[model samples]
Target: MPELLPQIAEPTDASLAASGRRVVEIEARALEHLATRIDGGGSNRTFSAACQLILASRGRVVATGMGKSGHIARKIAATLASTGTPAFYVHPGEAGHGDLGMITDADVVLALSYSGESDEILTLLPVLKRQGNAVIAMTGRPQSTLARESDVHLDVSVPAEACPLDLAPTSSTTATLAMGDALAVALLEARGFTADDFARSHPAGSLGRRLLLHITDVMHAGDDVPRVGLGATLSEALVEMSRKRLGMTAVVDDEDKLIGLFTDGDLRRTLDDAALDVRTAMIADVMTRGPKTIAADQLAVEAARLMETHKISGLVVVDEAGRAVGALNIHDLLRARVV
Candidate 1:
């Protein structure tokens, strides 16, 4: 038997590389084309019309689409709902069966399709129209049936697909995504949605914790506060700090206003000096003055910053009049996830 020759791999085709380059070029051109249309004179009218429909919606914005457009629609709906607008995704096929009942006269429908001729989407138009809900169409083809039937048509027309085969929805989907973002952001600004407002809707998110969680909510108050009088003995102050387990004690005046703080570091220094008298020495003599403090109503993250910046383990929480009302440490912030 003749020995089999070793098979060599064929070199990559230059035509395939050229095709890839062409796809990228088309995608870039599509984005540029969409950008130009947005700034064009007549295009503002289209945006204004879409904005009016969304602003006037008394109920949620129902987003529906088919195929790859459906995925983009879902993302658009999520972005809208999280930002400020009340929005949700509904499959067009589901709507034809029973989900059409979810939409009401008070709601607005946002339909997505690249060709603007998706049969699944078209099937619900008459029912939506009968329900008195306004339809806003997002499509690449303005003259397609969906756009023609829409109350407000948003032209997401891209020049071509980024796919080398020109069949896959690449550039068109990207343009559609960008347009949805533009709409959501525009509505977000129009509604004057703030960080606090966003936090209310996203209480479990990190941004919510940073914005909504105040120092007072997590600080140790009442009996947990480690406090000592200005003239209290070092031993007495240490006892209070140990009992509270806050690693520090606030030295307060008669009015309970914080004047100084004594910590483990202060105790260590006092111990280093053999001449220092723990029982006879006053806390006022050894406590560090001008200790860092924070307002109770301030964000817990801010308190964390102060602690980290000053190289301290704790802080005295003060009232509006600067009276020390509570105390918190690094552990408190860590437990609250504010760190």
Candidate 2:
């Protein structure tokens, strides 16, 4: 039978909060020390060299580690991949069992072992070397075998772990992860990666919708657009607005060029003038002239900004020739998740 462990008493709320604060402080100190190291000296030079090597490589970065470090490596790989640096994680132990075939000579290897003595990682060093792949090691100990054998060493050392017992991989892992983020951001800047590039990689999210969606993609075009001739009465404009359900109708000239816009707000103002009848009031007289308009090629986010700036809910989408080609409102932006 297995031995039963003793039950420990729960601590007070004050003690729990204090413990949490201490852990955070320790981790924060580790990051501060890491920042200082990267600001100058051998570590700074090595970091620059590592980034250059990755940038020069034609293939992806192969990140590998053992145990807890392996989890951090996986996250680092994901960050690198999403930020324009091609990278993926492979288990060191699994690599020995034929996963090594996944690596190519053109690729760069990034190995993580905090203590620098993970046998699983060290065992693969010789084969990687023989394959002519450049290796970058991230370790707490510079003198460790893995650090000594690699082409570049990233020092992720911390003063100590955040664990009360000083045995868990707390502060070291935090520092290592931060270092990984530094590498990714550096490469991102070197490659001139922009928000548009990031959005392309994340097409399923809200950022993608805001960046990739254009005014034409969200606007109602052709017969669906609410439009009325400049000679039309207020009643005809209202009928067009009701038929298209866009809350506004564009007033166009004889040549089908945009002249003005008649919106719900215009109707409210027209109703206040009891002398003018809806049946006879010309749309050109009651409509708002020189209203805010967006081009079909503009980003949908621009439409949102225009609406917010003018305190309006809809816009007329026009072509380069000043013709009404489409229509959209705040509701279309809401449905497209651009707002």
Candidate 3:
């Protein structure tokens, strides 16, 4: 049997909510202060110089920190790596245990410490210097040992801690994180890093799908595409739509050029006229002439947008000369996560 749970005392709902709001308010102000510090509140030159150092480095930015600052350092490293700068997080605690071998002369070490005196991180400064690795310090105390010995120092000091006890690394950590983001984005812009460049690093993510997956990558081609000759009957078009399961068919002339589009919606309107026999009715008579078409190389997300804008469920992929070469339906975009 599972052990019985302990009955823990709970704080008042009102009190807990108030505390939550207070924490957010403190953290938000901390971030604001950081912005101010970067602009004119302190010395923005230090931050700019730090960015230049990393930008000029030929190797990865190796980040290390202790405690809560360590967690923030890991995230900062990831952001840098994903946004054009190559970086990795090295735990300061583990650095003394032979993990220091990961450091190379070409690498730049970015160390984080709220007090700027984390012994685990401070002890590595001599080794970093010995290996010719430049140090960039993210710290609340510029006068601290780590800051004084570093190549550049970023002041991430906050007005106060969000913790009621004023002991936990709360506001300072938040400030440090904001500073890290600022550094990464600054470098990204300096390097002309684009969303396409970011997408390449995250190919399996949604942004990558939106940017990298093209219409040709999802559209049906050749015989698999639903298409009908302009001279074909409505019934023949319906047969093509059924066989291809695209809910629509392109109407092409003898030159194999797309002249119009026919779909289930067109069939519904065609059925309204009881005087006409759909089996014998020509497709061009009821087709939508010069319907919206996308290029084979167009982004799948753009195709999805086109469908959304037109209240459409399918699209025909066309060649430069307006010849239909492929077709795709909403289902295809859905499967591709384009919708």
Candidate 4:
């Protein structure tokens, strides 16, 4: 039978909060120390070399580690891939079993081990070195075997762990993750990676939607755009609005170019006036002249900003000639997830 552990009293609320705060403070200090190392400290040159190696690589970045470092490695790989540095994680244990084939001669290997002696990772080093793959090692021990053998070593040694017992991995892992982020961001800047490049790699995410989705992709174009001639009555404009269901209609001239806009808000104001008849009032008389508009080719997020800044719910998409070529509303942006 397995030996049972002794029971202990649960921590008080204040004690629990104190524990959380201490963890954050320790991790924050670790990150500060890491920043110093990259900011003109001894590790600055080696950090630059790591970024240069990744930027110059012709293939993807294969991130590998064991246990807790493996989790951090996976995250680092994802961050690099999404930020325009093509990268993927391979468990070092699995790599030895058959996954080493995933790596290639053109690839860069990023290995993480806080103690700098994870056997699973160290075992693959000989094979990786033989293949001529440049290795970047992140470890707490600069003089450790893995660090000494690597082409470039990033020292992630934290002063202490955040764990109360100081046995669990805490500050060390945080420092390692921060170093991985620093490498990724440095490579990103060196490669001139832009938001557009990021969006391409994360097309299903909200940032991708914001950066990649254009107004024309969401706006109602062609016959779907609600518009009426200047000579048309308010009733005719309402018909167009109801037919298009955009809550607004553009008022154009004989040349079919936008002269004004009439919306549900205008209808409410017009209704408040007993002197005006919906049947007889010309759209030009009741419509808002030169209302806020957006170009059809602009990003859909820009339309959201324009609507927010103007405190309006809808906008007429215009061409260079000031013609109403499209229409969109807050609802459309919501449907497109641009809101």
Candidate 5:
């Protein structure tokens, strides 16, 4: 057997838990401080001005930063892009190496530097200025070169870092990230970014399917819809249900207007209660009247909600005139990932 290592004393459980809690408390306090600084009634007009500048810009929002700030900058750019504002991230170090040409007069630059003195960011300022690129600086230091040179300076000052050593990015990065989210949300509302617009951006996500996929896209339409005449027998309705494999069938009047619905539950209830004879019973005598229906143009998620709320498995898709145009079941919602 290999030699056993001697056990060393670890910190007490209380000490570890307290340490984690202290870090979270400190970060939470930092976010609270940042929120007050950007309040409209506050002395700082930095955030509102920044939003106005970006809103008026005809070109993209170019984000640039170094090190930890660069990571936050990239996330901020992504949030901006997804929320409606067109934005992209470019590294400050890469700006001098032919990337400076990408900056145009119509573009606005958002540069992040916690210390407000990143040499790479500062050096490219004059060139960006010459190109008429409006600069917005997110920094902890308001008097530093980067902040002073920028057209707008939004302070993301944090009282302390979560790091015990005070060197690692912790609370400061969290504050910066929260500030970025605030800016993106503000712009999102200002631009009227709707769920449909968000769906188009995230076409592969579940939220996209819920917002963009309509009942018409997944409901069984045309002759494939499980439908039966109002005068049809219960046995004939069962045949239609079987042929459609929907476990339910819609009963319509002579005008093809939906009159009632019959499902497997009704069949079980009928057999148990001896309410009707399957061989000769009319469908109108046993079907549920005024059943919940979905419009073909409604979102598939709405159908899923109706089914879930009513504890149902299927619904008839009806037109504005109450005609049976399609049929949708819970399985269809599942297949479309709307469930």
Candidate 6:
């Protein structure tokens, strides 16, 4: 018998690519399952109970979990806190050691465990119960001890794992995350939370600037505003501009109503004409008419947009009657982070 040639293994189709596609399909199915479960009659009571417990919370919602579930719990807690519902995350393992002190009768506990039987989380149930705190459990198994002990149980079960080995918490984790988001959004709507409220929670973020930053908040007021009265010489307007250090000045009428504006660019253009006398030429003769202006009550982001659209660096903020009340430049918006 001829000796069998040595068999060499070459790569076929990429298992990594196949695995990615499988993961997407599994997550999609898991999300669909979650949607169906939430809409089903059995989940209505649980959702309603959970909402009532959260709505009745006098203190914070303390979210706790272990391992991968812990990460999701932390994110859920953060979302709740930022969206007008006061909440924080506690580690289940640490609760037994010292973190249990953070829980009080006024607070509600939201515990997450895929198996609904994490020892660390289960161990804190009695303490929480004794403290008279309400417990809401998010788990895959409804019959598990954590679920049975909870005041409200939210089912986050999936059909199966995305992992072919069926040992990893893949689809189940996705389902849990989606459920948490749904809860946060529902609470947000029920509370009539507005964008201004959101801005208060995220004062340092871009959305805060867009929603909370008023033009007056970033505008130059009082003497810092470069201004020149009507009939003032172009030379005098330039002097006011230089003294104010704004590179420009508003030309206003006797009543302080803005009539026009003069800038360094106008100065350069006037200089090109030897016949234009700085001392004798009035600002009105060379000033640009109908210059762009913004209201003091307008949003700084809108001011920024006007500046960009007009290709100018500054704007005069006026009152409802069109009298200049303040001034602002690109630098102001930049400093306010409204740009």
- The prediction achieving the highest TM-score against the true structure is 5
lDDT of 6 by residue, 26-45 (tens): 88998998887774785377
Candidate 4 stretches with Cα past 4 Å from truth are 1-9, 205-212, 271-281
lDDT of 4 by residue, 1-339 (tens): 999999997999999999899999999999988887774665359888888899889999999998899999999999998888899999998899999999999999999998889899889999999999999999999999899989999889999999989999999999999898888888888889987787787788787899899999999989998999988988889988999898999998877788999999999999999998778888888999989999987889999999999999999988999888999999999999998
Q: How many clashes in each structure?
A: 0, 0, 0, 0, 0, 0
lDDT of each: 0.90, 0.93, 0.90, 0.91, 0.93, 0.88
lDDT of 1 at 316: 94
**Candidate 4 — what's its lDDT?**
0.91
Q: Positional deviation of 253 in candidate 2, in angstroms? A: 3.3
lDDT of 3 by residue, 1-339 (tens): 999999987889998999999999999988887886675645458878888899899999999998899999999999999999999999988999999998889999999998888999988999999999999998998899998999998889988899999999889988898899999999999999987798789888778898899999999999998888988888888888889888899999887799999988988988999998877888878999989999998789999899999999988899998888999999999999987
lDDT of 2: 0.93
Q: Any residue pairs clashing in model 2, and if so which?
A: none
Model 5 clash pairs are none
Q: 74-147, model 1: which lDDT tens digit per residue?
A: 99999999889999999999999998888888999999998999999999999999989999999988899999
Task: Evaluate residue 166 in candidate 5 and report its C-alpha lDDT on the 0 to 100 scale.
Answer: 98
How close is every model to the real structure, measured as TM-score?
Answer: 0.78, 0.86, 0.88, 0.88, 0.91, 0.75
Error of 3 at 324 (Å): 1.2
Tens digit of per-residue lDDT, candidate 5, span 1-339: 999999987989999999999999999999999998895474768899999999999999999999999999999999999999999999989889989878778999999999999999999999999888999999999999999999999999999999999999999999999999999999999999998899889888787888899999999999899999999998899999999999999999999999999999998998886655679988998999999999988888889989999999999999999999999899888998897
Off by over 4 Å in 5: 1-16, 40-43, 205-207, 274-278
* Model 6 misplaced regions, further than 4 Å: 1-22, 39-45, 203-214, 229-251, 259-302, 305-313
